[model samples]
Target: MEGVVVRRVIPSDNSCLFNAVGYVMEHNKDKAPELRQVIAAAVASDPTKYNEAFLGKRNEEYCSWIMDPEKWGGAIELSILSEYYGREIAAYDIQTTRCDLYGQEKKYNERVMLIYDGLHYDALAMTPVESAPEEFDQTIFPVDYKRSIGPAEELALNMAKDAHRKRSYTDTSNFTLRCGVCQIGVIGQKEAVEHAQATGHVNFQEYR
Candidate 1:
């Protein structure tokens, strides 16, 4: 693998899965409704295939719940989206740090990468990404949940975390105020100024 890079950050709201997929595919936030519709429609159209056993709810009910902005998406939704888009969905499962590409025909070369960190799903893409890891290197990663992660992969994940921490969450400068008090994004300039106004610590940097 060349390297991993973040293309976008979907909000941490419950609608994150749909929003993340939409952001990755369309570079915007408007496709969630359409994606949800496709998932619900597909599920409703075939109850046997997407039954309560698989979905944990009646087809119609699951469809309804998934469409709600508050409901979270999972493997079932991911499959539906992959089929609807006719593109492979690449997922970086954060718990295992395993990158799995999901699709049937493998006819389309285009792919959408999503990162699932147990609680949240985010959009991300890797550099020099291949259809499979072995396509670039001979390493075969075991998917065993009980196994420990290797040093190199662990380092890569740590590096990704550190980089994300250093980078601004928002690309737009207007939304972020880099505080001179501390370089990290948690406290914006306005907050810094407010603190200064309240206490006399007046060092601030406009990040935008």
Candidate 2:
């Protein structure tokens, strides 16, 4: 059978990263809470490694923040989870059409795939056919599986291009947002973060 890499959409909940990782790792999409706990514990257990300089917040504060179900996970979480799972995670960025491999420096023998479309994350799996059952999915691949990895990267690039053509990604650097609390207009992620820091308004809606 000619296997193909397919992008599996994950729910747009705040924990999409964890859910995507969960789906790719265990074929279960509901492991967000458990994964969040894993990240929190990992952070708490190593303050020197996950310090405020790296976390952008106090280690303890970051741990508590990560454990919140509504909080989103990103690079820091990815690194911690990569160490926890002892496998590399290749996250294909739809905006940049680039693959960032977590745990690559760790020299892991296996890796899983995820697609990041700026605002959300999804899983990538190799299947026998487009309509193959999830149980038949192959999300983990050996690092030395050059043939599989090559095609998987191609598929991810194609998916990224398609998403780009659809303008389906949030341009964090240049998007306009309105704070849901104070209803103030802010431009880009930087401004939004500044507004949030000043007013404690964590809720925002993107606008054209």
Candidate 3:
């Protein structure tokens, strides 16, 4: 991750984010044209919003607090670009807001790990601490890092596995499809099963 630059996103950087959207579309060529247009609109309007919407669509709480900055302190939108597998990737465009946990502890570093834990998936680590020591301070807090996974299918499978593992005993056969095409599952009971049936996908097996 050396030479990797993490900077705040600005209106001027929209083009770069737009290119990232293009890269995503090109990578997931099987995605529907209408879905691509909707995504393009979101990306073109605001990369931060696009990122939030994407996460929201997946039902992730990562970006759900963007609307209320008061509850989560200030919000920051950032983009990370790096070279992987001989290609440059828009590693992440995360929107994070700080929250004061109910604890007397100070000067403690909080770490959060996001595991793909799916077939052909990748694992990512996020922390509230900045990677650069010089950038660490009281005013500046690293909320979260938005790491990119490969494709929609991989993302879906990962989500599905997580859903199943979380609720194996209760309604193990039901789940919600977060991403329409991705088919990311969220375990539920009868409601989840109905949702899956509505989506026309019934493959709910444990992650190997």
Candidate 4:
């Protein structure tokens, strides 16, 4: 793990799942809500592509629900991120110490990790090897790593176990944000994002 560090996005936003994966996939937290929309659209376009146990609702209904910015991404979003983006998603459930690998399971070369603390999911990505954390002026994604990197499935599991024991992943509802335009504050990152989706004017920078 020399020459590498795990990328992290905190605050327990409802977008942690997407934000975490996006940080690895796109290297930006802002694209998280947009990523949710993309996955929802993907699931809507192909109802048969996903497993029933994870669908949670009728295909169309679930698709619509997932598009809501307030909705938290879970197994469904993880699957979509893996398949649509063509990367393996190694999700570690801290409670069970079990790792669920999503993607083609054979063909996909790149991979990302999602930690499931039973009630919440958090993204964990290793920093690129060649670059020093403080040396980089701009963040890069998994695909941007020009050099080959080996899979660290066991490493991901260990990290999740440590995080779970440390209570690193908290329920996202505890975050609060105040809108810049409307000057209205909302509890939970979900509510703040939903408000932004509706008004398109809130500056969620005023985090509480």
- For residues 91-133, what per-residue lDDT tens digits would candidate 2 score against the true structure? 9888888888899888888889998888899999989998988
Candidate No. with top lDDT: 2
Clashing pairs in 3: none
TM-score of 1: 0.58
lDDT (C-alpha) at residue 10 in model 2: 96
- Candidate 3, residue 161: CA error in Å? 15
- TM per candidate comes to 0.58, 0.91, 0.16, 0.63
Model 1 residue 178 CA deviation in Å = 31
Alpha-carbon RMSD to native, per candidate = 12.5, 1.9, 18.1, 7.6
* Least accurate 10 contiguous residues by lDDT in model 2: 144-153
lDDT per residue for candidate 4 within 65-134, as digits (tens), equals 7777656777767877877777877777776677887774445766666677655565565544634453
lDDT scores in order: 0.61, 0.87, 0.29, 0.64
TM-score for model 3?
0.16
lDDT of 1 by residue, 182-202 (tens): 554434434544666665543
TM-score of 4: 0.63
lDDT for 80 in candidate 2 is 83
Model 3's C-alpha root-mean-square deviation from the true structure amounts to 18.1
